[model samples]
Structures are given as structure tokens and as C-alpha cells.
Target: MTAVQGLEGKMMNKYGYGTDYYGYRKKFVVLVPSTNTAVESEYHLMKPTGVALATRACVIPSIKVTNEEEFVGLVKAIGDATEQGLKDALSCEPDHVIFGYSAETFWDGKERSDREFKRYNDIAQAVGGCNITFGAQAIQDALACYPGVKKIAVISPYMPVGDNMVIKFLEDIGYEVTAIKGHCSPGAVEIAHEPFGKTRELVQAVNSADCDLILQAGTNLHFAELAGSLEAELGKPVLAINTITFWHALRTNGIPDRIKGFGSLLSEH
Candidate 1:
């Protein structure tokens, strides 16, 4: 061997690094509500190889659910907290940022939602100097997988106000919502504690042949695993917000690993 080959072989022989766990491809910064406990776990469950997820939480002190007024106030508070959380996440110098919360995604209508998304996008661009993913846009992209799907069954852990916002957004985007079943959970923390079995029941409650697909919102409800099973039984897509959001983040970053048991969006699309 030549002198350069001998030196390279000696260096290789003396030291070695183990296999890369994350492939060192891209780092993902995730933002969620402080009371949320499900986003991190679900994201990890479906995360593809070569991708790393780092999370930061927006503070939501308490949830007061007496009436619509309190609900509106809580949403505003969550929005404020999300802004701070986004700032914190951008400090990580991630390749991309993922918004793991869903309620704020649906505002008054499509125009308002688009404006809000642009605002968040601008902040992410300025701070992280990278692309960002939102749950609302992911859901819309997931729906595109089912070309003939015009009507859908919906389930959420939000109150009536939040549910209405979601419905309005979908309708404005040209999809008909056949039915929406809200758990009306007390607050963010409570929503995180919702049992997966209960979510399955909600799917059953809203599901019908009339609807083309089933969609579960509320990122903290833990529906990734259940979505796969429900899709098999119903013979249609059962998309959880977390699954689509993660899928979008990965695809937007050009990571196309097929993740199984989470639903077709990650596995097939």
C-alpha cells in the first residue's frame, strides 16, 4: 500500500464509531402545549430513521371550562404560549420545526387560518431560518391521499367552540363534515389523559358508510396506533393529527421512509 493508504488503514484500525442512530440527517424541533403529554411519545413512535426530534412546550397555566367565554380565553392564552414556545424551539438551530398542537390551526375560516399560518411561518423563517410544518396543512395533505373523499367523520378532544372552528375550516376548504364528535375534555392536561380505547369508541360513533374517512384531531389524544387498526376495520383511512403532522415534517424534509402500523400516510404515501 502507498503511504496515504497505510496511514488511513492505521487510523481506521485504531478507532471506530458505531452505527449512527439518527443518521445525522436533520434535526426536528417540535412545539407543543405545556399540558400536552402525547405529542412527543407519538412522534417518537412514528419517527423515521435519520431524523431527530427535539421538543419545547408552550405554557398553559390552567383550563377553565365553564362557558364559551372561558374557552375563548383559554385559546387566546394558548396562542400566546405557543408564540413563546416557537421562540424557544428556534433556539435549537433545527433543520425544521413542527407545530405539534392542533387547536390554534383552525381559526375563524380558511382566510384567517391562512393568515395565521403565514404569521407563524414568518416567525419560524426569521428565527430558525428553516421550514416549519403545521398540523392543519398536514391534515389537508393527508386528505389528498383519498382522492374521492369529500365527506369525513371527525373526532376531537376539544370543546364546542374549537370543534366549530375545525368544521368551518374544513368546509371552507371544500370538504363536507358528515359528523363531528367532541370529547369536550376539561382541558389540555385532561385531554392528554384520555384513554386510547375512548378514542376508538368515538371513531365508531362518528363513522359511517356515508363518510369517506375518519379524522382524529387534538394531538394529545394518542390515536396513532388506533388509527391503523380502525383503518383496517373500516376499509378507509383513519388519520390522526399527530401522524399526519409527523409525516409532513419528514416528507417536507425529503425523508421518505415507510413507517408501518401508524397508518397509510406514513407507510404508503
Candidate 2:
């Protein structure tokens, strides 16, 4: 039998003993907007053996974003809903918390993102009694794995307003944006539906010889597998937001399984 099959049988043997799901070594409580459809699916695809992912939704009443103003407003609403989501996730008493949304991670600028992270961190500590991982902090940690990578190309499914915020945060952290391309996707659900072919085209459009790496932002884009493939073609690191977030969560919880075909962040570091 394969290793996974062996593990599965072992877990079944412990069923009568009242162990957690599959004798999971860790549990991650993920919080996402109600309109989001990608985070949970992607997380499930990449989750390693003995790790369980439990998701909670932050309620958002609508997803009809037509303009930059509406887009920004919707992102703010998602952020507002996270408080309730955090409370719900904490009830599960997970080993770690993961913010499964990305647009809000770039709101305002670095200062605002830091304040927001602190708010979420406090909530996780007080209620969940655990540390949390999110896009902004995860990206920062992922970038640190590649030394001397100063110039980067970016691709996202956000409007100009959101793009500016992402750029601001990167600049604040001392990285130069060589090129950036945004899909300007109409709504939350629509962003999740964006074709992987389009993402490939976006990466090609933004790629430059000066760019040390290519980074994809937007939790709904489903770029983890593609990022791994593209890294071979581009001869530089290609990072997806979900990969970074997952890698951060695993590392933070002291798990290092070296997941492959998802990017260097998981496979190498």
C-alpha cells in the first residue's frame, strides 16, 4: 500500500478511540468572504496528509461591483464581516487561523494593513487562542525566502484602487514593482471564475528581464499549480497568494512536508 493508504488505514483503526479526523496533526480554521468560492477549494487541493482545513464564511450581502468605488466598498464590507467569522472559527479551537481573502489585505497601505493584521491577531489570540496567517504577512515571508529579489512583476484580479494598495504595500517594504497587470474583474464570484489561460497571458504581459520574480495576488485566481509550472518557464520564482498563505500556516505550526508541484515556497522552502 502507498504511504497515504497506510495513513488512512491507521486513522480508521483509531476511530473507536475517538481521535480527531484522520488523527490530524494540525487543524487550520480558514475565514473567507461569503462571496468567495476559491479559497476553500484551493486549500483542500493543496492540504497535506494529517492536516485538516475548516472554513468559516464572513458574510457579504452582495457582489455587484461595477466600478472602482464599488469594488473598494465591497472589500471594506468583507473586512467588516471578518470579526464575526473570527469568532465562529475560534469556536473550533483550531491550531492556527488563516485569512482566506486577499483584496482586504492591500487596503489603504502598509500602515493600514499592519493595523488590520494586529486587529485580526488580537481576535485570534483572545478567542481562538492561536496565531493567524494572512496574505500580506504571508507574501512578505515568502519573498524573504528569495534573497536579493528586489524587482517583481505582479498580476491580480483587482481594480485600480486595489492595485494601488498592493503596490503601496510592496513599496513600503522596499521592493520595486517592475510591472503590474490587473484583470479588473467585475465581482467576487467573477474573479473566481477567471480562466487560468487569462492568468498565463497576464504573467507573460508583465514579465520582464529586470523582474526578479513574478507574484500573483488575489486568493480567488487559483494560481498555485500554474505558479509551479511557470517557474520552470520563467526561470524565476512564481508565487501564488494561496501557496504563500498555506506555506506560512504550515511553517508557523512547525510542519515541513515539502509539498511539490505548487511552487518553491512549498517544495523547497
Candidate 3:
């Protein structure tokens, strides 16, 4: 290796100086859509130690939409743009690549988010030859950590079609979705503009005794800010999808479970 490359190798080496370099605490990169905000928020909350993170934004000019046609077109465009963004983010040589946008690819009918995640992973792996995980996979792993959480309620800023896809994706993975409610977000930009207070209300509205856990879906919705508060008030686990996603991401990378102030999910898991 050249001088700079040798230095980089030493910096990234998990066991370079007789120190337990911590397995899984390597470089991570995220391909974020320009209009979305969840990935950065979740990354801050996790405060990954001994790991590096970088991001490349896809060509999402705005998340605002007035009609269905425009929204559909935006979603399709986001998926294509983000895939290309991931190809670029991989150039940083991340140990794992996170596709940090949701609802852009999650659709109803024959298509589903899981299929899209796998497809994205395939592309990322082919280009970068590294491990890959998406926000959905993290949510799935978080659900498994809470064995008693069989039924769940969701609050998101997604349209009905995108909402159905999330519900279906979770159900396909084996959880009983009890209640789900979301703002009629025509696109991701609108979701980003939603006030945090409104999201809290929606979260509490769907929370019920039947539901053991409450999920704040969508990476752009900024649910981690309320997870602990919601959990205290509702007396149940309020899992933000972004929070869970990062929690799982950290775990998959062998990072320790030490994040604080989010909820019992991240710290406890």
C-alpha cells in the first residue's frame, strides 16, 4: 500500500495496536435522499463509537406534492436516483451501506419494500463488495429483540399506498399490526416538514392496550425525538423505525448497545 493507503489501513484496522479495535465498528456510508432527514438524526442518536459514517444525497429536489401523479413519479425517480447515489457513496469504501430513504421505493401490489431492499443490496454489494443493510432490516431485527411485542401500532407521514406497503412488509415478517395511522404525505418532503408535535399526537392516537409496541415508521419523520417520552406516557415500547434501524445496524456491525436517551430499545438491546 502507498503511504496514505497504509495510514488509512492502520486507522481502520480493528486490531492494529494491541487494542480490541471492536469488531463491527468500521466505516459505514448512507445514501440519503436530499429531502429526507431521518438518517442523520438517527445517526446522531446512535453516536456510534469507533465507527465512521458518510453520506451522499440523491437528486431529490423537494418532497412536496399536490397530486397522486406527481407523487408516483417522484417515488420512481427517487429509487433510481438513490441507486446511483449508493454507487457513488460506496467509493468511500464503507464496510456497510445503508439506503437511508423509505416510502420512495415501498409500493403496494406485486411490489414491496423487501424486494426493493434486496435489489438495492444486490447492487450495492456488486459495486462495493461490502455488507449492506437498509432501514427495514434494522426494524425487523428490533422487533425480534422484543419477544413480547407481538402487536404493534404505527405512526408515520406516508400516504395510504406507502402506508399499506409498510404494514404489509412488517406483517410479512411475522408481526401482527394492530393499528396504523399516518399523515397523508403526498411525498417525502412533506413528511420532513411535518411538525414533531403532530407526529407525537398521531403516535399517541394509535397507541392502545392491544398493541404491545408502537412504531414510528419512515426515516424522515423524526420519531426518535419522542420515543422515550412516548414510551413513558403510553407504557409501551415506542420504536422509531430510524432508531431501530440504527440499533440493528450497530448490532450487525458488532457495535455495542450503548446508545442513551432514545428508548429502552437501543440501550437495552
**Highest TM-score, which number?**
2
Better candidate by TM-score, 1 or 2: 2
How far off is residue 114 in model 3, in Å?
3.7
lDDT of each: 0.83, 0.87, 0.73
Q: Is candidate 1 or candidate 2 better by lDDT?
A: 2
Across 153-198, the per-residue lDDT of candidate 2 in tens digits comes to 9999988888888899899988999989999888888888889899
lDDT rank, highest first? 2, 1, 3
Error of 2 at 244 (Å): 0.4
Error of 1 at 57 (Å): 1.1
- Give per-candidate clash totals: 0, 0, 2
The order of the candidates by TM-score, greatest first, is: 2, 1, 3
| TM-scores for all predictions | 0.90, 0.93, 0.84
lDDT of 3: 0.73
The alpha-carbon root-mean-square deviation between model 3 and the true structure, to one decimal in Å, is 5.1
Which stretch of 10 consecutive residues in model 3 shows the poorest summed lDDT?
16-25
> What is the Cα-based lDDT of residue 249 in candidate 1?
90
* Model 1 per-residue lDDT tens digits across residues 85-107: 88888987888889988888887
Q: Whose lDDT is greatest here?
A: 2
